[model samples]
Target: MPRYEYRCRSCGDTFELSRPMSESAAPAECPAGHADTVKLLSTVAVGGSSSAPAPSSGGGCCGGGCCG
Candidate 1:
């Protein structure tokens, strides 16, 4: 299942929902009892990061530089 974040355009109410990947968009009213719920896609955390972190400077390869 995928989690979706929503924002209410009428009342500025923000909420989240968990559903399938193929599921549809927003439905009825928002949590603030408003009918202006807009689906925000930019901030959606769909998946995890793929890239790894850079190497550290502190290491023993530089002739005991790390302990210095």
Candidate 2:
């Protein structure tokens, strides 16, 4: 389940709800029972290491000083 943030325009309240991604666009009722609400843009944080290899310090013409 993904969490979605919403803001209630009627009561000026912000809240979050956990639901399926398929119904993410569905309207949500605020905790104050306000029907006039709009979904907010949420930022997602992805955690993991990058697959790209690190730069080598002892390779290439630059490292070997062959260009000069």
TM-score for model 1? Answer: 0.54
Q: Least accurate stretch of 10 residues (summed lDDT) in model 1?
A: 42-51
Q: Who wins the TM-score comparison? A: 2
Candidate 2 lDDT, 1-68, residue by residue in tens = 89999999998999999999999999999998989999988654443557777767768668867779
Clashes of 1: 0
Error of 2 at 39 (Å): 0.4
Alpha carbon lDDT of each predicted model: 0.69, 0.87
Model 2, which residues run further than 4 Å from truth? 45-68
Pairing residues by index, what is the TM-score of model 2? 0.64
Could you tally the backbone clashes for each prediction?
Answer: 0, 0
Q: Who wins the lDDT comparison? A: 2
Which residue runs of candidate 1 sit more than 4 Å off their true CA positions?
24-28, 42-53, 56-64
Q: TM-scores for all candidates?
A: 0.54, 0.64
